[model samples]
Target: MFVQEIAPLAGSLGLSALVAVLPLATVLVLLGVVRMKAHHAALLGLLVALVVAIAVYGMPIGQAISSGFQGAAFGLFPIMWIVVNALWIYRITVRTGHFDVLRRSFGKVSDDPRMQALLIAFCFGALMEALAGFGAPVAISSVMLVALGFTPVRAAVVSLVANTAPVAFGAMGTPVVTLAQVSGIPLNTVSAIVGRQTPILAVFVPLLLVIIVDGRRGVRETWQPALVCGLTFGVVQFAASNFVSAQLADIGAALAGAAALVLMPATRKPAREEVRAAVLTGVATEQLERPEDRGEVLRAYLPYLLIIVIFSIGQIPPVKKLLDAATWNFHWPGLHVAGSSGKPVSGNTFSLPFLNTGGTLVLIAGILTVLALHVSARDAVREWGATIHELRFAILTVAGVLALAYVMNLSGQTTTIGYLIAGAGAGLAFLSPLLGWFGVAVSGSDTSANALFGALQVTAAHQAGLSAELLASSNSSGGVLGKMISPQNLSIACAAAMLPGEEGTLLRKVLPWSLGLLLLMCLIVVGQSTILSGMLP
Candidate 1:
């Protein structure tokens, strides 16, 4: 088998690293600057990666092609699978006329746009992220905000920003689990470090959400509730991740935050007369027409309740083992090459874990939703087909991006780039989380980002005399910010908002927030590495 080369361009690491970054740069410029569609940008990025791997990196064309196919297949199976099914479930709810009841129920909670954003976009969105992730929170919450009368752009932006805090522990803590596996760190230790870092952000994310939703006025009117929500979520997340169970940390935190919101008394002073009149008129219309019924409310929430139950069942060890027993695992053909580290590169394989995967659980939840709602199988099938049709572009974007990631990784281009960044030495602590931000910005999955950079972060931390756990955890915490700008996520937000060609606008809206939060995470990580070294568990 052919071994990989980290510095393939005249043995110059910097030049090799620049060549390695061509694919990522191509995507970013095409999407963010040139305003290309996400799928088109991803395709162009994939082509650039292929050229770099074959020509500059000297990877055999056959192996590069095989690796790309492998990554694309993975993107379709679990990633797209989850998104499509989650949207389909939502469609079923809307079709059964239950979503209206759900919206009205939320209106009953608080009709203020700012409060709605906090309750739905931030609090409920975190719960979705904790369980499903992979665009589920954005897709579901953005649509909910739109139904609640937010402008499409505002809804998309709020959902994207709100998605940040829970992301590190998202999809049943998959990102942290991947970090531990790749970095050779204990799961609990990595989880604890991440817990310490992200909870700080979590405590302020609701405030950020309110500000984004209604600017300074939003924060002014809602600071008490926002603080209550954030503090509750952050504290529970910290406790659960460090003291209880990392896997269930976000679940506990989300529940606590939601409970806190439900229990807290609304104390906002009355709006100005006209504004209060408009708000009351709207709430009166909704309540008069929809009239929330307890059963309908339960049914409105049943799909998500089923989702929690199904996912929890799938996580049970014995049940997980039984389900995963049927998983398929195999090396990709024609890609059995090794990396510069003497480890197999393209030949690395993972179990498909079809039955136990989060996507499959979501799919099962959708099926059960149909049964519970008593919808005809024909209608359910139609909605599923419609969900797929709507996500065609998203599928292409995600698949192409994953293919590019795999090609760069297998050809050793990623290693060259990573090593170049790691060369920052002691200063690398400040830049460590940015590495994860870059990875997630490209791959569109925090789990994938952790898989890409977790080991690299550990290696760099050793060289720089930094805390490996802290830096590795920073990779995940920082990646949460990158999700807002990820092309795949942008596509999901756009589609959910029914503004397919407005991705650039959405990216522009969320980019500053993403960068600002990433910078904060960098400061936190740098502190943990030096002055706050005592914080490491």
Candidate 2:
């Protein structure tokens, strides 16, 4: 068994932390500053992590290789699987031309660019995040924004930014569940704590998206809708997570946000210049003028409605239990790694939840979408093939970064860095969230981030006399902001936006928001540990 060592480099915590960070730093700087293609950066980052694990951390080569493959398998099967099928649903709509009609329906609601963004990126994106997270919201929402006439890059940025508000409870509260399990906190307590935390982000993210999409002019014209959307989302999420169920939190918030916007005073149509820009972008801008036929409108909306209905049914306790039974679990071959306490890491055992995953559920939705949209079976098959082909590099990028994360994690590189940060003691209240942010920035998964550091957060909190449950739950809250800049997410958004090689551009654009919000979460955590103790469950 390979035992983790938190201070392996010459038995020095500070020195080990610096060396431990090289692989992650290599990834971020190469992807963000050097403007490297995401797959290339990710693979190179994996290579660096491999060397660090063996040379510095003393992880055996056999277990190291096995761990890398295990992570790569996890990424491709359940994670990217969700994205592929979700995009296929989008492509099926495109095949029927219903996607354009859906776009026009948004124009019918409010052709104001700002309002369109509020609906698609924030409201709709939150709904998607609720049902099927693991990159599904980014992939589908970014493409929907493009169809709504936002620039490709802007759509990507908007989708990435909009994703943060609902993520702590994403995938039916997977991240929070993972955190509670790892941290030894009660699920309700962790859920309640994160419920209080992420809603704060929910209140501000819509305003931030407006600022990103339209600057001051957009905010000036549409701040009312943005604020309404954000407020409703935040309020509903808080209620659902604390009072109802964390699994239903984002679903409730998203539906409420959408309803609030629809009920708001209608805004004006897109301006002449906006129409011209849409035309230049090949948007068939004239369709906005078409009088909506009732049946056509229903057909235009059928696919998404179908997705909601199917996912909701799948979430029923009995149905979910059945699906859960179909999953398989096994220890990864030739890999055994224990933490400093000599317990085996849960991550080293792989669970293949083929039936329970959102990916399979999305596939069911795609099949139904094919029938509802009247898409030919032949065409649907072709689109699925095309989806796989289109996301080849994105698939590689996801797998590579996940492998890098696993290599770092199983080898102790990640814990070394976590220990260095946790060493901050009472200042840990101020710095607690960074461990999660760093984990997510590396793995592109808040769920994975919690799995990596949730227990560590609780352990550190105990040592520092802080609230263990609060700090543990805060790991997930802080990790949400990192989603925008995660290399895997960057690749997924770029792929869906059809800006395949622009991951670096997208990273540079979203990095400021990610860091800025992470700082805000840090302060919130510190306050919760002291003055804001009433906020805790």
Model 2: lowest-lDDT 10 consecutive positions: 278-287
Clashing pairs in 2: none
Q: CA lDDT of 262 in candidate 1?
A: 69
Question: Clash number for every model?
Answer: 0, 0
Query: lDDT tens digits, residues 1-537, model 2?
Result: 889998887889899989988987887788667878878987998899999999999999998899899878866877678768877777777777787777677656776667777888888788778766778889877877777667788889989999898988886676786676546588789888888888888888888987887788667867887888899999999988887666678888998998998788844544457543542352423357778778878987776677667767776899989999999998889988998899998767787887877678778878987887778889999999998997798789778877877788788887777566666778988777887888787667787677656766765676667788888888899999889988779988999988979988999999999999999999999899888899887
What are the TM-scores, per candidate, against the unseen true structure?
A: 0.85, 0.81
Reference-based lDDT, residue 380, model 1: 91
Error of 2 at 159 (Å): 5.6
lDDT of 2: 0.80
Shift of residue 199 alpha carbon in model 2, Å: 1.9
Cα RMSD, each candidate: 3.9, 4.6
State how far residue 203 of model 1 sits from its true place (Å): 0.6
Best by TM-score: 1
State the lDDT of candidate 1 residue by residue for 1-537, as single tens digits: 768897899999899989988987887788667878878987898899999999998888898898889768766876667667777887899899998788777756765677777788887888778766788889888777777666788889989999998999886676887677556698899999999989998888899987876678667878898899999999999998997656578878887887887676762333455543433222122332456779989999899788777866776789878998979988767777886877774336744777876678888888888999999989999999998897798789777876776777778776677677777887998988898898788667897777656766765676667778888899999999899999879988999988888989999999998999899999988888888888878
